[model samples]
Structure formats: C-alpha cells, structure tokens
Target: MMVGATIIDIGTRKALEANGASIASGALAQANDASYDIVSDGGGCTDAKFIISGTFTTAPTENTTLAVYAQPLDIDGTNDADAPETTRPTVFVGTVQVNNVTSTQYFELLAENVPWKANYYLHNNGTGQTLSAGWKMDVIPYTSSPSA
Candidate 1:
C-alpha cells in the first residue's frame, strides 16, 4: 500500500526530521541497471528520500527521468538476484525529473500502516547521460510502541 502523498511539488514540503530515530545516509552512485539492490538496513526504517544530482559537460536531453523503486520482498524469499521482479518486486516506486544536464531533484517513499522489508532499485530511462544520487533512509519510531 502507498503512504503519504503522491505529489511531486516540493513547494509544499517542510523540512523533514527523523525525530529520535537513527538514520542511515549514503551516496548512491548507481548507474542504469536491470536489477534491483538491497540498499541497506530497513529494520527500523519508515521512509526513504532519494536526492539525485546529475552534472554533465553538456545539458542532457529533455524529459529524461531517473527512477527509484522499492520492491517489497516476499516473506520466504532469499536475498538474491534470482528473486525476479515479476514475483515480488514493484517497479517505478518513485522518480526524479532530469530535464537538464545539471539537474537536482528528489523523491521520497513512505511506508503505510505496516513496515515493509523491501529492496531499492535505481534506473535511468535515458542513455548517454551521467547521473548520481544521494540516498537517505529515515527510521520512524513504531507507532504502536509506547515510546513512539
């Protein structure tokens, strides 16, 4: 299930806070790929934000998109490449617009009622362009917990 909003306008977004939970942040240098990746620990994670930047010598073609996907793994699935997308992965979880060669954009994923153990995937729909992403995953205190 989807959580939060499906809006792309960052104008209405307020500064995000992780509250008291631990956050894992890292640089994502992934290129266009056909496979999904287990980004990191989602043990106590509730949401994830992918801030993408693409710096190029020349401006890239217009309407290019860089996508971020979070696929909920099957309960009985093993952490391996063999777990095909059709079986347990969901594609196109979120995307960023890279209309310019030097583009900066972001996309966020928030879990619904229950937390999901999923892997993150990145892909660029266009070729001949170079892009990189910085990813941050936020852990929210479990709502049902007394301390939350």
Candidate 2:
C-alpha cells in the first residue's frame, strides 16, 4: 500500500539511479521519476519514516479517518489501545488528527529491517456521517546507507 511512498536515506548513502540514468538524470528528465536504493547492515537496523503527502482520487469513507499503527508482535488480529504493546506494535506515528484537505495530510512512521509491523484503521471521527471515498497515505522510509 505504501509502494507509492518515496524512500530516502537517513545518513551516508551512495548515488542512486533510475534505469540507465542517475537519479539526477531522471529528475532532469521530462518524466522526472527517481528513487534511492539503500542496503542495510548486520543485526543493526535503520529508521524508515513515512509522511502523508499525497492525494486521494476520492474522499475517504465519509468521516472515516485512517490510523496507522506499528505492531511488531503478532502479525494478525486487531489491536486494543489497552495492551497495544502486546497486541499492536507501537504508535510510532499517528493519523492526521483531522480530516485531510485537498492539499495534503501528514502521517509519520519509522521502519526497520527487523520485521516492523504496520497497519491502518478507518473510523468515523466526524459527527455521525461517513466519509467520501478516495483516501491514501503517502509514505517515505528514511534510509541509513544508499549502497550498504
């Protein structure tokens, strides 16, 4: 679902390229599409944070808000706020807190090579009405090194 999210390295990283062109080349191209390729080290992991910075074809399911959570424990089942650490992973990032405008809403998160879990939930936070339809979270994972 976050396939559309852009990825960046947190520190020292090698130059990235797209196809036969470097990231700069791609950015300079008419299409202007590019990304960085990062490799991880040993047991040590890196941080991959994501921020909501895109658009939705349609409005969200009316009053429905999307919440992203980190669940490193069990891969399945729903999480109750009570024992989130046991059921859910962690609240590395929260929702926009308010309805996202046509502009852009922000949701942040961090990911590591250590099988960190992630999930999104939709709820009607507005009055009692539902949401529109289209909704999506733009994510970007911070990297440590470009080429390991």
Output the number of the lDDT-best candidate.
1
> Residues 1-148, candidate 2, lDDT per residue (tens digit)?
2554554545442211112211110011111122222233212334544343333333433334433443233345543232233234344334444343444444444545423433322222331223323333333445543332
Q: What shift in Å separates residue 2 of candidate 1 from its native position after superposition?
A: 26
Q: Estimate, for each residue in 1-148, the C-alpha lDDT of model 1 and write its tens digit.
A: 2455343312112222212121112112222222222233323434434433334444556666545545445546654333213224344455555566454434444433322554444455553454433323232222222221
lDDT of model 1, residue 39: 30
Q: lDDT (0-100) at residue 55 of candidate 1? A: 46
lDDT of 2: 0.34
